[model samples]
Target chain A: MNLSGETKLFLGVIIGTIAIIVLAAVIMSKPTPPAPAYTRNQLIPIGANTKGNASASAFLVEFSDFQCPSCKAFSSVVESLTEKYKDKLFFAYRHFPLDQHPFSRTAAAAAEAAGKQGKFFEAGTYFFANQTNFSDEFFAKAASVLALDATLYEKDRNSNDTKKKIDDDRFFSDTARLPGTPTFFLNGKQLILYDSSELVKAVDEAVK
Target chain B: MKEKFLNDQMTNRILFILSLLGVAIALYVTQSFLRKTPIVCLNSGCELVRKNPASYIAGIPVPAFGLIGYTLLVLLTFLRTTSTKLHKTLLPWIAGITGGGVLFVSWFTYTEAFVIGGFCTWCVISAGNMITMFSLSLYSHSHKK
Candidate 1:
């Protein structure tokens, strides 16, 4: 078939436009690793400090960082799940303070210190709620709001025990090869399903 | 003259079939995204790959782009098959468009394999369709007199 120069130029423009669009799409999308599957057999012992039913058959373990925006966003979902499941679920929160967040370790330390006073969950809730305003003063204010002993809280925050607790959780996170913060494991199995409804269904199945 | 006609007919038929296949795969993904339902996946990574922020461009699903591309290919193929003048005019352009789709699909496939660490079965099917269509279009354009 004979082709005109004008047609060739038009085709070239269409092809170039498509190429640019595809390239832009690819560039805009960030790559993320697939969530890993963890088995119940590999479940580590839940630490002394945790929230929800201690005797529940199903456990939801969250490896979270206070400064992570996704973790903050998921906090309310976790709270709703805890309320809905109540006695049926054991919720364990572990500290996995990422180094990228300048104040994450301090926040983790504050939460751990609050745990020493049986107010870890409360402190965690406060931190996640006020993630943008995290500071030494904020941690102090949270401790006071929880009615924790200010002196004891300060001492505990700087204690080796608190540091070890955070380190231990980090160790478990590393061993599990967690891809990022806000990762959840239900009864030791990673929740790879992204949808909340699907996750709820999975939880219901596990309960059975 | 007869041989050339036969070749054109075969090329058009292949392009039509492949375009249909591409459209089906893209439609499925688009629907899954819109409906907020789990996509049928032989591989476990489909959910992860789909949920990734990378799967969308400015909140628009990537598969929507695939749907548009495949739909265009179908229209182009139909035009090329029905009108001799249009066929000559559109054949090279079809090859170019298919080539671009192939490149895009290749990048998506690479992300699924290397970055996402999980493959979506439907996505793989769509990529396969794009590759086959690109090959057929390139061959037809080159063989054209």
Candidate 2:
């Protein structure tokens, strides 16, 4: 069967035309979605150890791991801001121990155990500031140092209360679709702070 | 028709098939974006690379670029007239660029799986497609007398 030259040329044009149409359709179909409505108070969450009104106009929630360096730095910023804003802001701390970090969850549970004695934030801040002290002895010693009720701390440390808190915090992390630790939620919306300046800007706006 | 058979009929058919699959995957991602579903990548490297905003150039996804490249290859394969030596010469160049892009994406995927801890399904599929296209292009073009 002798295939004519013209027939081959025709085939090329037809298939080429189809490919172009498909590519163009794909390119044109996806347009980036518009940015969500945002405000300052709706951007950063209040964390545990924070002393403030829950009914405050703005709330900040921090999802963090004790072993993370960035979480420690971010924690410091939050602490200063908390002091700066004192009465006007609300803060909450949620634990999100990433799978790669071995000691984060144990530290989180230990902190929750402290929470039962009204020292949750104190223990958590201590853990972040001194992450190298993640050994069982170190954590137990921190509990003793904070003067928590030893019996209750030990019970809650190994109890459902600790696991549930960790699990509950994980739920928010998943909801925010966080890719890494130190994820912050201002109000209930995901807060992406690319830099410290952005974070400060967010807090300033929230206070406004 | 010998020229047409060589450039369009045989080679173009495979390009068209591969390109269609690439387009289908691209469309699926678009739909996922529109529906606000998480861009799930079971491949660790794929997920890590995708998770990084730095992976995109000017907000355009790397896979989207792959989609355009595959589509262009398909067009070049099917639209080139057999008698034109220019189209014949261009085939390998198109395949080389496609192979290079795949190579870059593959390195990132490797880092994700071995170094990082996640996977991306679409990236793996696209890499496979590029490898297949490169093989086919070489096989078809080399056999031409």
Candidate 3:
């Protein structure tokens, strides 16, 4: 079974053509979206955060990292809503650091340090509010703003307890299927946070 | 010797196409695996391999490696059309490389299934591609007779 050089070249061309076509088709296919946000949510609570005010009737759990810009934006919206709907809504913040973000876990740890100073919510609020100013110097500056003891802030920031708290939060975030930051679970149901309006509508719905 | 060489050349062409088919299926499965991100469950353990840091090397997915490897194998088949002594030596080395790749991926699949506790559809497809390449190489090696 001998084939001429021309025949071999022809076969190669045909194979190449088929390969190119199949590869092109595969690459061109539209990608599927992530899990639908409107789906059910059996909200899993994180460490020491017992669904925050269980009696509040409406619960909103946020999967966020202090260094995340989107989380910062959503934090403001949540704050406004929480103030307006005070005592009617319960808000809980959980850490979910993007793997590539270098300073996210550090910011999370710093927040925990401030929490030890009885300023968990305050530290969380300020951390997201001042995310643009994150650094060693800025962390200390924020601590000063929060009136936390500098000595304890430094010691607690490096403490295993702080790390464990972040890790535990991570576990809950992971279980909740929180892909990236700023994911919200309202009333044990997943809410679409694509836009503030949608979020607000979802939140208002929960309260009703 | 001429007849023997021509026979080997044609056999390589067939083997090349077989490996290419394997590569194509592997690519399909790779895409399938990535589609189910944020893998919610470990029932199948596919998510473990999908999320594994080693799943991609230098940012290129593993299936991409197989795609390129098979394409090169296809090109090498065309090169063998004329019995050049240089290509005769190169073919076995190529075969060995393909075989070694199969072995490496097999171990990866094993680790994913047993150690990581997850089974990735794409990883399985890539493993299947390697097995086909290895088998085709064996067939080609025999065709040298």
lDDT tens digits, residue span A1-208, model 1? 7655544543564466457656755764456455565553344354545666768889888888888665765677788888888888877787778776788889999988888888887887888888879777887777678899999999999999888888888888888777566677898777754544556687778767
Per-residue error (Å), model 2, residue B11? 6.1
What DockQ values do the models have? 0.04, 0.10, 0.05
- Tens digits of per-residue lDDT, candidate 2, A1-208, equal 5545754665665677568767977886687554353443433333344456766887776778887655765777888877787677777777788776688888888888888788887887788778755787887777678898888888888898578768777775766567566766666656655434456689778878
| Runs with alpha carbons beyond 4 Å of true place in candidate 1 | A1-48, B1-145
In model 1, pairs of residues that clash are: A1-B145
B35-129 in candidate 2: lDDT tens per residue? Answer: 33345454223333444444455766656676677667755665454446745777777678667767866875775556433456787787788
- Docking class for model 2 is incorrect
Residues B3-37, model 1: lDDT tens digits: 55337767876787687678768877886676544
Chain B only, TM-score of each candidate: 0.92, 0.71, 0.64
Task: Mark the 10 consecutive residues where model 1 chain A has the least summed lDDT.
Answer: A40-49
Instruction: Show how many residue pairs clash in every candidate, following the order shown.
Output: 1, 26, 3
In order of appearance, the predictions have TM-scores of 0.53, 0.54, 0.48
Q: Considering summed lDDT, which 10 consecutive residues are worst modelled in model 3 chain B? A: B36-45
By DockQ, who's the top model here? Answer: 2
